[model samples]
Target: MNIDDLVKGIAAGERRALARGITLVESSREDHRAQATALLAALPKEREALRIGLSGTPGVGKSTFIESFGMMLIAQGLRVAVLAIDPSSSRSGGSILGDKTRMDLLSREKDAFIRPSPSQTHLGGVARRTREAVALCEAAGFDVVLIETVGVGQSETVVAEMSDVFLLLLAPAGGDELQGVKRGIMEMADIIVVNKADGDLKPAASRTCADYAGALRLLRKRPQDPDGFPKAMMVSALQESGLSETWGEVQALTDWRRANGFWARARAAQARYWFEQTVKHTLLAQLEAPKAKAALSELSDLVAQGAIDPTKAAQDFVAQLER
Candidate 1:
């Protein structure tokens, strides 16, 4: 399809056209990439929407939280789009795409669109085409775009970069989970939500939430919204409780960044990182070529035989490849 037709159709909120446009961007074919760039450029400029990222452990009820939160956001007269990343299985290298089934109620909402696409070897539990998909969503006029991660791995930082607000959802089950979650990735949450706060789990969830709140006090706050409060909340995604509070926090954080001029700097940094990644990936593809692959094999043999150090061999390989 031509760029103009696809761009116009997507701008008019055509789901099929938007899906096809994302597919084109995801493709590795050389010609398809050229078209993808054209389509990306055709997207209109829009910066008024809120971009929120949600991530947590595998069983933290991410899909459910997203569904409940999405419903609430739409009820408040905002259009929402969810892009949930489903990673490929280690064995089959194909995603199960189970998020849609998990979000049955939100799935039926015409104003809310939930798309779960495979990671396909992309970094940060997201598809390579996700950035383009987000831009497309913005151009199509979604008031809010929520990008959900595959898990709580270090890959979470990748999603954080694209979002205006990064929220970490936690399931405060009890004793050990509190201390256990104090490690690397989960601590970087701009807003932490302790989910499943209803029913029999309420007491345990509350205690765990207190533990996290204490934990936050010890660590230096990353930065602050204009309100001067670190964004944190406890919510029950299944019961549809506490969602409004969560939205309030998200809005406060975004507004703070805008009023403080941090928003411009953040977007500029995001663009630089995006450019670096594009260059890095292109070079890696060439290094993995069959001819280069054979040379790398020879380098490994030479290094193993003690004929050359690993670093020297790598530099040699790079020097030879450029010729």
Candidate 2:
């Protein structure tokens, strides 16, 4: 397909083109990387969608919640795109990518698009191509882009860096639950929602909300959150209750950050972070070239045998690369 046609199709919200664009960026081939870079450069500089990062502990019903939340957004006439990051099998390097099946209703909506990418060897619970996928979605005129993490350790902090609003979902549990989550992750949350707040879990969900609200009070607020500390609420994604209110909170926080100039600053910082990551990745890839790899192996053998000091060996490797 012509690259110009692909870019135009994406800007016009052609679903097939958007899917292909995402695939292009996710590929690791050098040619694909060049194409992806050109595609990103063609995209508009201004953000056209709200980037939301949703994360939680395992079994928090993140998929179900996103299905419901995404439907709600669609009903409001918003075009929603979901980039669901699924864990890859360490042995096989494959993922189920079953989020579409899990979010059947939302997936069927013409105004909604869902793509599940494997988090293959990428830490922080997100797919390595997530940032690029988000850019494609925004360029495709998606009004809201939701990034769902794999619910692994440290994922919340990582996703928080990429999103306009970071929402932490919790199950209806007690203070013991709080103990398991990192404080830094909690502090990063712009909003917190206790899911499954229906039936027998309703009371517990309310209590959990209160517990989180209290805990948030004790933590220092992020400088970007001029509206004060994070807000906690209860929602029953299955019953589809409190979803509107939750969305309202998200919008309110987004508005607050934009009004305070924090949004622009945060995006600038994210760009810098990604730029540094690209440079590091490029340098590491260069170090894996055949000649460099052979040199590294020799250095490793020397260091392991104590024939040369580790620090000196590293210096020698750098010198060789320079030469």
Candidate 3:
């Protein structure tokens, strides 16, 4: 398809066009990259959506919560877009991509768009093109864009960097699990939610919420959150309870950041971060060219034979790239 058609279709909120645009951006081919660049350039500069990063442990019911939360947003007449990142098989590099099936109701909503992307072994618990997908969704006039990570620990920090608000989801009996999670991830959270807070889990969920609230109090306040430390709450996604309140908290955090000038600064910083990352990616790709590969092989053999030190060999390879 033509670049103009793709840009116009995305701006018009055409689902097919949006999907194609996402596929284009996710493509690794040079031509597709060039086309994606042009498409992004044509998009509106003003961003209007709330970019949220939601993450938790594998079984934390992230998909369920998102469906409930997204439906709530749609009920309020907001267009919600979910960029769900599915974990790729380590051996096959394939993903289940079943988030759409999991979010049956929300996926059927006219105002909600769900896109499941494979992690493709990209670190940071997200797909490589997730940020670009966010831009596309925003350009498509989505009022809220939710990025659901693979929920593996450590790499979640990358999501925190890319989002306006970072929400950490926990399940009942999470007190011990909290100790296992990295303190940095908890520190980055603007809001903490304990899901499955219904039925027999109600009491446990409440306790988990309290435990997280207390833990958050002990950590240094995130500078961006003017409302002080992270706030914790309990909710039942299955029952769809407390969803509105949770959304209200998200809006409150977004408003606070916008009012404090942190929002704009954060987005600007994210843009710069992506720019640096793209440069590194491009350079690394160049290093994988046939000639570079030949040089690398020779360098590896030399290092293995002890004719050249590893560090020196790396420098030599870089020098060859420069030449």
Candidate 4:
């Protein structure tokens, strides 16, 4: 692939070129990794887009909410990109990649770009290359980039590192359900949205939203937010109700952060974070090399046979690497 031509195309906001760019970043091949690195380095850094991370459990209607939200953004004359992470099977390493299909209307929009990627057993509820993909989208001139996680869990907080606004989507549930939700993920959320707030469920959704609002009040206020922030609201993605209000809140929070100098600081911190993560991941990848794999196999046998404890075996392996 001609990196120069690809860069030109991306600068011109070509969707096809942007898609190929994301594919290049997601590839695991050594050559692809080098090209992806160059592609990222060559892209303009001044171009910026609002990065929103959306997380929720399986039945919480994340896809529906994203579709409605993306359409709304498009109607407002903004080019929107959606990176939906689908859960991959640990054994088969396969994903359904059905987010695009679920968002049929948004997928057909000329101003909307939707990309579904496999989680590949990544614990963060996002693909390993998602950060790079977001960069690609920004370079392609997207006004907003929405990252949809695989599902909400304890480790899903990792998305907070990449997103400017982290939205936690929830469904109408009983009081006990509120207690069951993990506090760690709750603390990471910038906005807690109770979805499906229409029909007979509207009352239940209102009650759930109130419960979450109260819960947010109990948690210590984060310095990065303005007054009355990290709050809860209700939205009906199916009926397209309350979506504009949610978007308004998101913009309000983001604008506040940008004005308070939190935005640039947060982005700088995120860059440093990804740099350290890259070093760790590169070191781990070395273990897959032929010689390293052989040594690891031998050490595994020794540990399994009880000749060496796992910790000692791991230490010896590290020592060999040091040599």
Candidate 5:
């Protein structure tokens, strides 16, 4: 389809058109690339949607949380789009796309779109095509975009790079699990939520929240919003308690970022980072094919055989390109 027609259809909030838009951006064809860029350029320039990142341990009920939260938002007359990324199965190397099933209620909402993508060899827990998907969402008029990341270590930071608000979700447990999470991820959180706070687990969740609040006090708080608190909260996804509080906290975060200029900066930085990564990956791909790849393979064999040192081989390869 032509770029103008595609862009018009997407702007009209046609779900199929939006999916096709993302697919075009992901395509490797040169004509598709040009069409994608032009189509994106033709869309609204300054997007005002909220980009939120949700990440936690694998069993921390992330999908359930999203289902509840997204449904709440949709009920409030807000348009929500969830860009949920499920990790590729290590054995089968495919995404089950189970988040859609987990969020059955939210999946059926007309104003809500839940797109499950495979976290395919990207730096963070997100799929490499996530940025394009996000842009498409923004252009298609989603007021909020929630990007869920995999539970991989340091993956939270990757989510933070693209989101205006970075929320770190945690189960109400202490000890080695907390230690397994890196301190750097802790510092990036604008909000920390302790899940499973209802029924028999309320006290445990409360204590965990206190402990996290104390820990957060030692680190620098992110620049404050007029209404938001940087403190931790205890939530129970199963009981739907504290879900409204969590949503309120996120709203404050969104307002602060948009008001205090952090929102624009965050989006701009994300764009620059993605552009640089795309270029670097593209260049590496160009050099790793056919003749260039075969020559590099020979150099590796030579280095292993002690015919040439690793550094010398690298330098010779660079010189060969110049010649």
Candidate 6:
């Protein structure tokens, strides 16, 4: 479909058009990139959604938690969109993209949309175009957009820049108090949820929650957060318990941010961040041209043979590109 048609369809909340729009945005082809830029520019900007970034270690039941949590939102008559990022195989650059299969029920809901994309070796656990996808979902009228990262540890913080709330899901007894106190992913989380809180794991989940809560206390409070913010909670995604309470906390935190005017400022900062990132990526992409590639190869060989220093070679290569 043409850019105009896609924009109209997205404004009308057509699922097919929204999917196509996301795929267009994620494309790296020059022609598609041009089209994606026009498409995004034409999209309605008035529509907005709550963007939540969810991450966890592998086997932490992120899929289960998302499915249960999404269902709860849908029941409240909220449209939900999930953008799940699957890690790409380093050798093959292929992704299973099996999020739809995993979120069986949510995928089937008329109000729920699930799109899984390959990370394509992008670092920080997110696909390079995930922010665009989130924008499209919001323009398509989703009340909530959930961004699920590849779940790599600690350094997987890029999602926080794009999301209004960052949730860190953990398995019960996964770590002790000291581990929770360590900075990095722990420091980035707005809410640390201990999953599998039902049945046999109840006690362990509670203790884990308390440990993380204490850890949150030790960390310096962010100006954006209200009192008791960045707290820990336990949930049982398997049995769908505590899902409502979790949702309540999410809403409460969001409301607090909105009331204090932090929400708008945060989104503005995110937009500026992505703009800078896009410019950098565009410049890097230019280096993939055949002439540039050849120049880079020659420079690498010269540096390896000690004919030129690596930094000087890089400077000369960049100068060649400028010319």
Which numbered prediction scores highest in lDDT against the true structure?
Answer: 6
Instruction: Output the lDDT of residue 163, model 2.
Output: 89
Higher-scoring candidate on TM-score, 1 or 5? 1
Q: Give the alpha carbon lDDT tens digit for every residue of 29-117 in model 5.
A: 86887788787789875556788888888888888888888888888889999988888876777777788889988988899988888
lDDT of 4 at 42: 99
Query: Candidate 3: where are CA atoms >4 Å away?
Result: 176-181
lDDT of candidate 3 at residue 79, scale 0 to 100: 94
Candidate 3: lDDT over CA atoms? 0.88
User: What is the full ranking by TM-score, best candidate first?
Assistant: 6, 4, 3, 2, 1, 5
Rank order (by lDDT, best first): 6, 4, 3, 2, 1, 5
Name the regions of candidate 2 deviating beyond 4 angstroms: 174-181
Per-residue CA lDDT of candidate 4, range 1-323, in tens? 99999999998899999999999999999999999999999998889999999998888999999999999999999999999999999899999999999999999999999999999998889999999999999999999999999995656988999999999998898343356344778889999999999999999999898887887777888899999899899999999999999999999998999999999999999999999999999999999989889999999999999999999999999888878
Residue 115 of model 5: what lDDT?
A: 85
The whole-model lDDT of each prediction reads: 0.81, 0.88, 0.88, 0.92, 0.80, 0.95
What TM-score fits each model? 0.91, 0.95, 0.96, 0.97, 0.90, 0.98
- Please give, for residues 181-276, the per-residue lDDT of candidate 6 as tens digits: 887888889999999999988999999999988888989999999999899999999999989999999999999999999999999999999999
**Per-residue lDDT over 35-145 for candidate 3, one digit per residue giving the tens place of the 0 to 100 score:** 999999999867578899999988999999999999888888999999999999999989999999999999899899999999999988898899999999999989999
Ranking 3 against 5 by lDDT, winner: 3
Q: State which candidate has the highest TM-score.
A: 6
Model 2 global lDDT (CA atoms, 0 to 1): 0.88
lDDT of 4 at 252: 95
lDDT of 2 by residue, 1-323 (tens): 47899998998999999999999999989899899999889976665799999998888999999999999999999999999999999999999998889998999899999999999978887888899999999999999999999997544578876889988888998354355345667767888889999999999999888887777777766687765448889999999999999999888888888988988898999999999988988888888799999999999999999999999999999999988
